[model samples]
Target: MSQAPQTAQQPVILTGDRPTGPLHLGHFVGSLRSRVELQHTHRQHVLLADTQAMTDNAHDPDKVRRNVLEVALDYLAVGIDPALTTIAVQSHLPALAELTLLYLNFVTVARLERNPTIKEEIHARGFGRDIPAGFLCYPVAQAADITGFKAQVVPVGEDQAPLIEQTNEIVRRINRQVDAELLPEAQALIPEMGRLPGIDGKAKMSKSLGNSIPLSSTADEITHAVKQMYTDPNHLRASDPGTVEGNVVFTYLDVFDPRKEEVEALKDHYRRGGLGDMVVKRRLEEVLQNLLAPIRERRTQLAADPGYVFGILREGTRKSQDITQATLDEVRGALGTFSFDRS
Candidate 1:
């Protein structure tokens, strides 16, 4: 989900992915694709959230540092024009940190505990038994990221609606606590295709789960990944009545392959038991290869000019800094947090 704010007149959209690995197909359908679409429609700010990545993976700078450029390259290669989009490094926006400090006071310790996103994450990471302070409080940081930019619309999946609620609560609470409207409330932009599934068919597609198809993957890598994708476990025989409801193969086809009639026919064939899993997988591979060929080719070209990608991020940070600075000024002034303290 994006932390961006939606405005009345082309509200600004703020969103980004972490740098733990290269961009994957999940990133494209889920967020990046919409980001490019929103460029001409709204004011967009794309953040490479290396800071948030540090919350849990703080110990691994090597992994974080290596993928930083890769993420940016994926952004540009996928058609996120730097000219239209403001690309910023998360940590570079110091106003966000400053805003976080103020927001921390408005939210209680119990409130943070009740956040559904944090709870799910804690459970997902097996940290339910023990949660880190940074991991818990970063939601407030995310609140700051949204309010600092005064974003109006955040693109997100239905599953991530709770995060949007949290952002809005913070926005309202901050305005009420300070007795002034210092921040802008934001909403969500949920796309038709909510969350992408993993190749292993384990719910959502994530890198940690090892069930992802990375954007930086070569044609051969794509071939390998699709060939091994999980299908209906119950259907073992060639003529066995198969299911595609939860199968990763059909789910992928539903999202990537636009030919509705053909994909549906394939699904029906599998349901009736005549179609083999191999045939479906092969068809899926063909569909994915066609869908990803352009993206892969573009990523290759961007990778060759790494310096240019970094330059885009640097320039984006510069652009974001200007607006964030103004927002900070107004926020501090509203709460008497700014200097001129004659005590």
Candidate 2:
């Protein structure tokens, strides 16, 4: 185990999305936008977490396999430059699985059950006592991912901050065992917009729920989704005053509309009276149409060239294998594990 030498190189950031389905506006607002900017300033590794997706989707391995390319397409469509960012598939990295198995020795089952993120997910999925071991131990796997890359920073939603905290805890435990800093502790970089609500006004925006707008939505799809956005139920008439606190339309406006002053003024009008739901919905529709047009176009073009997209993943994963193998060797040495020379 060793501390990384201090250098002027860009800080390394590890962030990723599960390949369960196509990414949506929730993904864009939460992390994708920040990733684009961070690439210029940080050594960014964008992982397509196909293995993590399998923790819950084990029954449908085909679904997990199919969406890896779908998620990668979303990344490329959203301006994630393969030249600036390393976009690798999670299952392709053998060292990560090895690291996960090794790191499990440092964490306990009781603690894993107590993880807030894990707890919430388990309950949400109605797993009860049937939770798969892989599902419960994903935090440990995440710790492996962060440390394998020696990532100094990780971009995630506010709800996921606890996972980063758990990762650091594993890092400290391993350092204490080895009497040296074997891995870097990762800090969570949460987006300012936090989590986006479902168009149906649910607290979570999920593709499975069918309430999220995919990044590749056409203009009509965008408009239709915005039309279904939840606003104040009490404000039935266009002239009636409305509440803005829990209105999903206003929430989307705050995030997507760049005209801050105008949105603020429109909010005031809606709160006082005279603003119709259609009027606000139209504004949101226009804003989203403009935002997603180029992204959808780019995705169509990129989707046409499947070979080019797979080549990017192949190259990135090859580069990642070298880095992770070095880290695994260091970890094995720190634990005094026996190794045979292949040569």
Candidate 3:
């Protein structure tokens, strides 16, 4: 392990999404939008986490495999330039698997069970007494993903802070044993809208809940989703005053609508009792349509060329292996490797 001097080159950033389903508006508000801007200033590596998704979905391997392309399509559609961002498939990076295996030796089962984010997810998924070993150990895989790329920054939601902390802990522990800082400690880059609610007013927008509006959704689909969005139940009539605090429609507008003054004024109108749910829903629909139109167009164009999309992943995976191999070699040297020598 060693502490190298900082270079003039841009810092590395690692961020990714699981290939469980198509990405939605919540993804855009949370991380995708920031990734587009960050690419110009940093070296970004986006991973389609097929292996991570399978931690719990092992029975549905096809789901994870199919969405590798879907998730990549979502990335390309969102203005994440493949030229600027290296998009790799997680399972394709065998070095990450090797790294995970080594790190697991340093971490304990009790610590894995105590991870706040993983605990919350476990309870949410109702894993109960039947939690899979792989699911509980995903944070190790995540550490591999970050350190494999030598990422100094990881863009994620506030809820994922613990995951980064755990990664850093592992890094510190290994560095202390090796007497050098071979791996970089990654920091969380939380977005302004770190988490977005579902259209149905759930705490999170999830594909399983069917509350998400995909980036590739048509105009009609956006309109339909917005139409059913949750608003104040007490404000039954057009003339009744409404609450915006928990209203999903207003929440979407606040995140997506750039017309700050206009949205503020509209909120005031709704609170004062002249605005109807239909009116507010229409505004949100229009705002989202404008935001998603170009993305949908680009997704359509790219989806037509499956070969081109997968080719990007192939190239990215090759590049990712090259970089991660350097780190893996260092790890092997630190931990010692298997060999047969009688020299």
Candidate 4:
């Protein structure tokens, strides 16, 4: 007999990123680092969400296509071992598409519109009445992705917790429709460090806003980005007291710096007056360079052997295809769909 979804041995985790751009520092702090750690203890599946990226980037299909490999390289560079985790491309998995269609029947458009994550995204994209049907139904697709794999845990930012809630609602509806506990509901595992803000101190670090530092950024690029990070505009002189609450440099340092005592001392000094922004920025730069150096080198090495990376993806996707197909077969049978094989 197969194990339960939440079996203590190795629970399944489904988490992924949209292939609209390369991942950045925000991704690392928010979820990627946890993913690296979780792989050792969980059956993890990371999806390259290219199809979802197209909901908004429909006009620029090539951009999404190119970033699929870029995102894959970022994953490999960050120490996500393909041997321990399955890394599959969304478009390559046909079962996910079919499952999405079937799951749509269990959800309503009104509820999709009410999903907090979807609402925020729609407002951010400024898609008022012109929201794409696909974009509005993204939560359904995510439900398909989760239930198709019977994922018991999903790592996501706090803002995305509502989507997981909606996914569970769909799972419950499906169980009622079929009168069987055929699908597993997922729980969101939010990181201790929540969403990282943009360099400009915006609420989000987004590539489209040009306020993000890509994972593949060079030393010079890292330095330049750090220099431009938002600090207290009132702190004109080094001796002037600065606020740490909104200082982006100190925020990055808190997350990236290893010496907690040193960071706390610096924070106290900044609040007390005498520490310059550049002084703190330099420290942050050193910490970031140290953290990203090995990752960048690994990414460069992986990029050179595209064939090897592609092979990993192909093999992972093949494994995922079988798993999803089995789930689909079970779902279809429960829904009483006619299968030629059953004839």
Q: Score candidate 1 by lDDT.
A: 0.84
**What stretches of model 2 exceed 4 Å from their correct place?**
1-8
Can you tell me which runs of candidate 1 are displaced by over 4 Å? Answer: 1-8, 128-130, 340-343
Estimate, for each residue in 187-242, the C-alpha lDDT of model 1 and write its tens digit.
88888777788998877788878999987777898899998899998999879999
| Lowest-sum lDDT 10-residue window in model 4 | 1-10
Q: Write the residue-wise lDDT of candidate 4 on 228-317 in tens digits.
A: 999998999999999999899988888889999999999999999999999999999999999999999999999999999999999989
TM-score winner between 1 and 2, please give it: 2
- What local lDDT score does residue 244 receive in model 4, on the 0 to 100 scale? 96
TM-score of each: 0.92, 0.95, 0.95, 0.96
Give per-residue lDDT, candidate 3, residue 289. Answer: 91
Clashes of each: 9, 0, 0, 0
lDDT of 2 by residue, 288-343 (tens): 99999999999999999999999999999998988888999999988788788522
Taking the tens digit of each residue's C-alpha lDDT, what string does model 3 give over 108-221? Answer: 999998999999999989999999999999999999999999999998788899999999999999888888888899998888766799999999898899999999899999
Best prediction by TM-score: 4
